[model samples]
Target: MYWWSAVGDYYWSYYRDACERSLLYLDVLRRRGEDYREQSAKAAPHVLSFDFVVLVDGRMLPRPVNYGLLRIIPPPEVETDPGKRPFIVFDPRAGHGPGIGGMKHDSEIGVALGAGHPCYFVGFLPQPVAGQTIEDVCRAEAYFVRFVADRHREADGKPALIGNCQAGWQILMMAAMEPELAGPILVAGTPLSYWAGVRGIYPMRYLGGLLGGGWLTWLMGDIGNGIFDGAWLISNFESNNPANTLWKKPYNVYANVDTEAKRFLDFEKWWGNPILLDAGEMRFIVDELFIGNRLAAAKIATHDGERIDLRKVKSPIIVFCSFGDDITPPQQALDWILDLYEDVDAIVANGQTIIYSLHQNIGHLGIFVSARVATKEHAEFVFNIDLVDVMPSGLYEIILTRADGAEANPQLISGDYIAKLEPRTLDDIRALGGNDAADERRFETAARVSEINRELYRAFLQPWVKALVDPAMAEFLRQLHPNRVMFRVFSDSNPLMAPVAKAAETIRGDRHPVEAVNPFLALEKMASTSIVVNLEIFAKAREAVTEAIFLDVYGSPLLQAVVGVGSSQPRAARASRGDIDLEAAHAQALADMTRGGFIEAGMRALLYVLASGGADERQFNALEALRNAVPEAARPPLSKIREIIRRQAELLRADETKAVAAIAEILPEDSGRRAEILSAIYRVVSGDGEPDAGEMEKFREISRLFLGKASPAELHDRQEA
Candidate 1:
């Protein structure tokens, strides 16, 4: 009976492993329940690694806001350089609590700290300050920036602002209002143009239209007694990916019970800690931003009667969006540029430098959370902050090339790589991708309908709902929400889960894990896959129905007329001011070309040539090194240097030949200085690799103007090099 004994051993191993896994899974749940209980007892809990003390509390403001600024104290291992530019990171307050930007070592704050920069975080309390408006929050953020700048007065520049998702728009608003307070601003996975998305491809944009718009939000807020439960927003996020929410997430933890528990629990801690918003604040965000699309159009006004115009922001803006991010697609992030400017010329004319980088396939959360992205994209952004700040006013596409010649894999980058900021045009953006006007019209109609519905609800339904509900009932509803119920049911407080801990302890002592080749384990995987597939099918069907209903209802000619959809085309472009005297500006640039000495002229020519071919991190680092090589007495202030570069770039753009020739006219006729300048230019251009034809030609032109034609020996040396 040897064959019978083998079969019996196989069955016993499989059965024992399965039972142990079940117990361990229950233990995971028990721990999760305990963690939830502990978290619930705290006010404004987060997962930040570093210690911090509050610098500015928004609650103490004249018009109180929930936001606060915390100065992160870098650990002993992480050195801080006070002379380096400081960084201020603002996490998204969409639905969850803060600290996503600094939750782990391979995160935004971590990268900044690694680079020896002082890091600060903008966090908020669990509850909003009563009657706090969006404008008040913006003011508080401005105050925070001013305080940070004051604290870092000895630093090279103002603090670089990093805004994640919802904080992106908030940061923009603050920058627009007080441009002097910001340095280079980086917005990750932020949607500035809410109505922008490719039809049929991204269906989340249609949800507001499908739900009859902002009235439902208003009703929910009223039911909550002037506080909107953030659980609803989190639920909406979960609904977008049902298979992940309902099957894959749970199955992943269950299938890898031993390893996945901590990860699942860590993420759930943030996911479960939903924050609240004032009713007015929620209404404004829904109506003005998502519905009216006012932010991009510069229609959003502050209490002091100043229109919040993004163009007013003097700092360079860096937008990081992903193609796979359904929540804030590339169109939503980049379309605001098209909305704000008529063309690339307008963007330059406004003296604004905008840089955008697109990740190929990172999801919404991955843009900010993925360790791979943190170490690569976010690190590059931080390292290149000064480069972006000094860049000439223009549109640029931040290109990250692979260091090892494979592909531009972010995970492969580990601080040693090449990053390029290539000049781009509005046409490049249009070619990249965006939604059409027809899609926008439907959203506009939804906005109008929402206004009508909001008025009707306030006039009728809201009063009755408010009179019926009290704070206790509202609290009960929040506690009974499906999102909360799931955590509560799996908690250790439940009598059914009492035996789980003891059973898990016993299983842990006698643990047995089945091999991957096991027949039962294979079956389990197949079952899990089938469950995910079925749930995905249902999700797709539901999305189809939702989109169909939205289109049919909002697309109706009768309803369109009622909402005044066709009254006039949406004001996509601002009226031409006809105020900028282009000829006068050109003349002024020409006159200013001869205003500097050899150092300035040489630097200008170098920048012009680099601009012609585009610049990457290598070129930037070489230039910085050259600048540092200059004698202290002769060195110009960095601000003055940037000003010179800006004026030189403008002149080159206006007339390249005149601008290049003017550099020779401006510099002294000293062959030694000229040779030194040419050598520096060669070094900068050839840092990454061989210079391209355009770069070579630009260099040759500069040389002809400054150092005459190269001799045969020089030409051969250049070719050989």
Candidate 2:
């Protein structure tokens, strides 16, 4: 039956079409690659014109790394003073070469420039200098930041550093190491706590465990004959989404082969130009980051012996990660919070502020590259960065929503880029990490085994491996590598390419376009997504089973001891012991909270009436009435008023029922009014101490009672009245 079905009319036609399309895809890719090389060659002179500086090695390389800056708008260009803010866009140094950030005007850089902020980009060399380390890269980034900051300090606002993927963590490390260099750092799709993620679901994190260690990274560097090819890393990232990697990406090009040639070639030009990393650098990342998982743990040290403690960074950290990003899942992006601080109070006590916004479904690169993301998420972040700065030091989950009223677009837009700030507890974040300590301990033990294996492999096999490898073989191997296939096939050396390039030029001039939202195509994409999800689930289950067996066998105490368990020093030992010094920060926050004089006081009075009516209903109601009667500018200070509310809440906590009865006695109101007042008091007191689920629920219930339900007719009537 299966054999007959395979030969049947529908099956035969579908399989035949797929095969023919695949062949066509290969042909187009070849032509596109050829065209891309020619275009790049034509554009080479323009690229090299910018001033280039090389740090770390203190020497310039064969190719110049160039960048461009766009300044924020002028005062005449806008009605306002053009509140000058500096914007820095750091391009991710993944396998792909440079220019993803500023490839188009409708990019991260473009959005910042259009918003009337000065923009600068940090691009990289085609090849890293020999013996350069990540620490050196970080220092270079810090120097760039300092230069930007100096330029903007004479202006008004501070620079907002936007780091994409690899640059994200690098920028954060720079901030931590040199705390004064940058401000309002935004890490889009950057993973800080590399090991923090849900088990089974995030299988990418399992790669090290499955492979037994960082040996593969070592082996790859060895095979490359001392230079690790970044193409392999890019390949791993692409492989995670097999539908995109194996089918969708190539299939889309073939379906619209004639039209998609430019866009495909443009992306491939950047994607195909893989960078090289020193063997030492690759080993450091594999051991300290991917497997050792020591950055968040605060165990990572610089070559000079300076520890990179993420917590030491005093600036506000705004983490932007999405559900669709498999490479840097929200778990990896966010779990660092849990690793560093015991709770929200610890964050507050340390005088550090962190805010994170999670996107529903945007992929890793899309977080930084997508035009919609640049407009919506990136735009709002830039406009409201100061508001984030003023927020108290603690963890917050930024709730983004459309501002429906006139207050929207007070500065940047005609429409509201409205955002609500909601406080989140440590427990809320830890919920993302579904595993327990036992699970983490298993990995910790695995790290020990990894170190032992790596050490032994180096001692026994490295000598033999090094002797066998020659510079000629290494060059040949690199040229034949899968990622280099396009470059080799489409180079000027390829005999079949000259005619196709001319043909492509003619085809480019005569272009056809289609809407991205085509119904049939979207349906096909959706179906493909479902199949991908199912495959991912199957893959995860298979991995879990395999890991479980491996752990059961190798996780024994005897095996662990032989493999050198507890050999490495505890990660905590590296941390500098000191009490959290929030004295200066607290004073600053208090002063800011107290500003605005009487108007702030009135706002706080209003908050008190809103919060403590049940306990001190008469006093708060009278205060609110007095506040309403007074001139807006003459209202009492908000800071003092909040303090009063805290005092009242504390009193109510001492005796809830009696406090309500006393307030009722003081207030000259009807029984119904007293009940309403009591309910408001209960709500306020409930929410006063610490933010929690139960408190929020109680507050919501009471808010409804005091605010009351409004009918459409009633609202209109009030408006008319």
Candidate 3:
């Protein structure tokens, strides 16, 4: 009797859920259609939660483009500090409309504003101004940066740049080209070394080769009447995970229609609104960057033939990537270092401080949008950015750990986690691994084939395609695309979907949700999981086949010759950026041995010894706290502090013994000031935990250098007692 009752209940719940879900799904589709209608009427649509005033309209620039620089208006409670460096956030325009960087209040812009920094945003309109090239866009962005900088002349430093996805590479190129214009830059999920990826993984890289390269890109632009619809790019993203795009997303909403609708609608507002790009812009992106992979190689040049070199960027760079980001893998994000510099020595020689943080598993979009990431990694970067800006030149990995509120100085760290940076070498980057020589040759062949195919298309098919497709036809075809059609057809504009809203309202007025423990609900979950697994398996298998075909076809020796990838020809290589003189640096450091007063000596001593205590957040907090304690006039500029730290680090690197002993010469002559410096060092180091043996040894040695008569041991022991 009980078994019969259970089965009856399951059947009843299943039937009711199916009916309610069908009605709700239709309503969602109706709402989505209305949203499309509403969004289409706007002049410049953005999903940014904050209001902004346009500072510079790219359309009005000498070389007009559709991009704009906006000054974000902070909320009433958020008082911005004009004295602090301004923050600028640029969202990716890979496909969808702009404003992703500030889409939410707890996002990149939000975090910067919350921290009292004046924030700005770089966004764009739906349609590009005619003949608007990528170069014009870059120039406009550069002007915007300069405009922001000029406004904040009283601020201590230049504005910090935060670039997401597509914007990452764009800003990187800008900074490299005009290095002086940009300050410290943070690029999240941005691809720099386009060709750098592990074989079998990152199948997206093989798309250009498999599709015969930039020819299709050209064809798309031509078909669009001199413009390219970004919908095509978004379709590629959706195709990457069919299960999620096709089934999982919709099913989740169906399962919990009550709460998921708002969230789904908000996301689709940005995702559904695909922007437009000029044919020239698309071609440049595909031929020069996507296929040519010339940015990291330093082969890209301005109209005046000035080279865009990554080494020229003098500001600190912080890269945030994730292992789970299949689209922009860590290899793509970080391998640019390897391509530009042969070793960590080369990076340091260029006077670059490149710090990267790797999250275990946040998807590509999650890097910019995930609330958890916004609270943790992004928060840390925002709060402790001063530490990064003035960090000594070297390669380092940024790591975050949960703050248990049990540390020596829990109050010091503002966020919930503590961020620490540890030194890394070239070998550390190499440990991620990449394609072998043979694989590289295959990619070279692909690039050559792409060039040939593009020329073939331009000569034979371009004129006819242009003749046939006018602006009206292009717009018609764009609306007919699978991505857009779904939004348009299911909308209230459709006569069939007209009754959905009314029906949905009636159902919702008397809806009864099924219990969680319902047998049918459990079955639904299992079925969803099974579908996801199958879809993943299919994606992997398909990717494997794609990889195999690309390897087999491109690796053919006959094709290699025809494509001009022969052994004797050789690939064009950029000049070595690692031309550095270690001996000269060491000598320079030695020459400047006794240059500064108490500030230099104190900063040097603390930096030299902090590593032993694990230079964590607390030490930095303590240092910042100390710096703040000093009157504004008395405090040395961060630039001056950074110069002293770099010189001292170089001296210590060249000769640790001599550098340690020279503290006596660099220290202020007054005995009272010497004691105060020692006290400050102890306070900074001891912020996190008890001093380790290595740290205490350095402390005692420094104590001896400061006070010769007091035995190092006696002083330390007495302080401990």
Compared with the true structure, all predictions reach lDDT values of 0.84, 0.62, 0.85
**Alpha carbon lDDT at 60, candidate 2:** 38
Query: Candidate 2 — which residues are off by over 4 angstroms?
Result: 1-27, 35-83, 405-416, 470-472, 490-492, 496-558, 564-577, 581-721
TM-score leader: 3
482, model 1: CA deviation in Å? Answer: 1.5
Question: What TM-score fits each model?
Answer: 0.94, 0.72, 0.95
Clashing pairs in 1: none
Query: What ordering of candidates by TM-score runs from best to worst?
Result: 3, 1, 2
Better of 1 and 3 by lDDT: 3
Q: Identify the candidate with maximal lDDT.
A: 3
Worst 10 residues of 2 by lDDT: 43-52
lDDT (C-alpha) at residue 718 in model 2: 38
lDDT of 3 by residue, 1-721 (tens): 6999989988898879778987898798779888887888899888999988989988888989899999999999999999899999988989899988888888999999999899999999999898887777878888989999999998867889999999988888888778889778999999988787888788898999999989999999999999999999999998998889988999888888998999899998999889888988999999988888888788888888988888888889999998899899999899888878877777777788899999899999999998778977888899988878777889999888888888777988878888888889878988988866677778888888999999999999999999999999999998888877888888987899988998899989989788888888788899999999999899899999999999999989899888778755443455666457778887887877767778878877876776532357787788778778889989776666667777677667667777777777878889878876777788787777777888877777777778764544454454455
- Tell how far residue 604 is off in model 3, in angstroms: 2.6
Cα deviation in Å at residue 107, candidate 3?
Answer: 1.0
Residues 1-721, candidate 1: write the lDDT tens digits: 6977877777777788888887798788778777777877887788887899988888898888999999999998989999888999998999898899998889999999999999999999889988999889888999999999999888877899999999999999999999878899999999999888775666788888877789999999989999999989999999999999888988899889888989988888888778899989999999999888889888888987988888888899999999999899998899888888889888888888999999999999999999999999999888878788888898999998657655332332335566888889989888866666655667778889989988999999999999988999999888988877877778888999989888888877877898887776888889999999999889888878877887778777778788788735664656342346778888888787777777677777877767653667777777777787889777665666667778778888888877777887787888867767777777766766667777787778888877787532474365346
